[model samples]
Target: MSSGKGGPGLPQERKVVTEIPGPRSREIQERRLKAVPPGVGSVLPVYTVAAGGGVVVDVDGNSLIDFGSGIAVTNVGNAHPEVVRRVQDQVAAFTHTCFMVTPYEAYVEVAERLNHLTPGDHEKRTILVNSGAEAVENAVKIARYATRRPAVVVFDHGYHGRTLLTMTLTAKNMPYKEGFGPYAPEVYRMPMAYPFRSELDGPATAAQAIDQITKQIGAHNVAAVVVEPILGEGGFIEPSPGFLPAIAEFAKANGILFVADEIQTGFGRTGRLFACEHEGIVPDLITTAKGIAGGLPLAAVTGRADLMDSVHGGGLGGTYGGNPIACEAALAVLDALDAEKIVERARQIGDIMLPRLRRMAEKHPEIGDVRGRGAMIAIELVKPGTTEPDPARTAELAKACHAQGLLVLTAGTYGNVLRFLPPLVIPEHLLNEGLDLLENAFGG
Candidate 1:
């Protein structure tokens, strides 16, 4: 058995006894076609039967190297024993009272812990939610309520969530925004400081963005300026050094709330507890979800007390928000983050990925850029001799890795970026092997 929880943890090695999907997974996929909706996209059609460490074992008994971490939700690892134990204990005690109706100590404890752990030590408040989309929506609601403004400003290449307001806030159009509008009104957009693509420096980009908001949207009318300190879906574009702090500074000075959407970059995934910490950008509101409760569905919008408190009672909750079971799992995840040194582990992941990627970039002209912080990193693929996005090549590389039992996730507005979000608990040898497999894909 693997040392920690999260089901029967698979071994550290990648083993494929059958084809990538194998026969059993293919049979299950056939069943899924009849039962599940076509809207639900499966990253890997091979169903995960047992997952642990750095591997996910499908029902066909194929063990694949995990590079996605279930889209960065399992930082500690799948079915982490500690998280599993907490969930089991909580389940035995009582599963749900609908926190809104019955209230639970675990919910309050989780809120208290978030208030303390998030960036600023000032008086803060946290409202738990069910997913990243919910957390973001609530943050926008709170900001709009507190600021009494009709407009919200989001940057270019920033992905908030899938809900109406968030999809409006999201810069991507095809899959996320196409056919989904008429989106929420009064959501304004500005250019983000994409160093690789933009000509300006960090401060210069910030200046231009602020200027555009002031001229185009009128900063006074904007309720909040939402950003991903490190862009999530729009590519793992780490805003240039001064970009985030500059944006936050503008938001504060202009009576606009700065909302950090840390859904993909939070909870030790970015080498820090929050990606904002990397730039000393303490936003007025921070939305967290993905890595908060291991594999559990839990999210929170933690923010300044006065802003969050501005919303009236019964205005900021859902039936499933902050369920006791998710709270318990989150508490255990927090313990693992602190005791097991997850933040440092993320830094170590970057240390391993950056150097190897940089070397690979040196050799492969198709790799246009290698960027990210801590474990949340990516490589942008482009034409061999130019900066034009090469999405076909990117897809080909990812498919090559998938064929070899290495699970890799791709992202970017151009769909030419391959992201790596390995679990912090991934074994070093497994990580090395995964990288080696990735290199082989690039070589082919």
Candidate 2:
């Protein structure tokens, strides 16, 4: 790793002064067991004290190289200077004006940015919300309100969120949808054109999916077709080429809305402003969160003006929908995203990471597929000589990496994909260092 030249407040090296969850963190974990519920789980529960650039410092003074970015939330880095400054200033001025009550310009500015930056160039409108689930639920609400249709088409191996409606929309059944029952109705699941597994090419897969949707759900009854350009929690699956365009085209042809859930793929995570851009598919509505506000709780649904306007003003807001602090942070995030060259950085990261991961796959027979774009990448783990999911190996490898002071996240419906979401600000040397740690963990 680089000796110095880390970002402002973080070092560029992985320094493990103690064992991975040292005595101090272990004590905290005991307290946490008493305070926090078992249902609320964590991949790594070591209790972070400070984080920035590419490293998370734990309570015991060990610095672990971050690959999760809090699940793609810290794209611009933790405690980004401009974001911190803006939030500090805004907090001092007034923490909460409650945009729905007193109103604020920061909220409006964020909406304007979302309207301008999202896929569409046409006249658009934006509504802010508290989380990605809220954005998604609101998108569906708006689509139904506009189209007066009941059925909403979703895809397999897609994750929306944990809210009642979004949990139903999510494909996985275990943690997200298990005990939660009576999911929101009128949400239909469709086949996704995952390139690695599907036999058909992109266009054929799209055609097959469209045919199934037409026969099963019918064109006139569908309100929207909600999809993630790159299925995030579903193993970073990049749907085959022409799949998204076909879906978007069918949605439009039938007067149904196309909603692109960019919650995990937005703000340069996928080497583009939005992953839909990669397919040249301009969606009718786009949901964004995570990386948008530099770790603040914020999400938005930006859409066509007419569709958004159909909901009426009073129908589409919450008291804390556009919290002033989050808005200010988001404004700062946009500025940093542009000024720091984050989009370009994402592409550069992919350039460095993809080759290394492909090389690793070559060495490790357990690696089934290395897929995804930009900083949002994943390696699907499978049994040797077959495509059966190897979640046990994935967990073992993750534990080994954690022991070595590296943080990685696992994803996929089968829970066998190791996803890498290192912050765009992560120093190249630190990233390489983290990858080296992974190589060692995997016995390379």
C-alpha lDDT (0 to 100) for residue 286 of candidate 1: 94
Off by over 4 Å in 1: 1-9
> Candidate 2 residues 1-444, lDDT tens each?
223223356766789888878888899999999999999998887877788889988888888999999999999998898888899999999988678779989999999998999986899999999999999999999999999999999999999999999999999998889988988899999889988778887778878878888898898999999999999998999998888888888888999999999999999998998999998999999999999999999999999999998887699999889899999999999998889899999999999899999999999999999987999999999998998999999999999999999999999999999999999999999989888999999997
lDDT of 1 by residue, 1-444 (tens): 123223534567889788888898899999999999987888789987778889888888888999999999999988888888899999999999998898989999999999999998799999999999999999999998999998988989889888888889899997898897799999888888888898888999999989999999898899998889999899999888898888888888999999999999999998999999988888899999999999899999999999999998988899999999999999999999999999999999999999999999999999999999999999999999899999999999999999899999989999999999999999999999999999999873
The Cα local distance difference test for each model comes to 0.91, 0.91
What TM-score, over all chains together, does every model reach? 0.98, 0.98
Which residue runs does candidate 2 get wrong by more than 4 Å? 1-7
**TM-score between model 2 and native:** 0.98
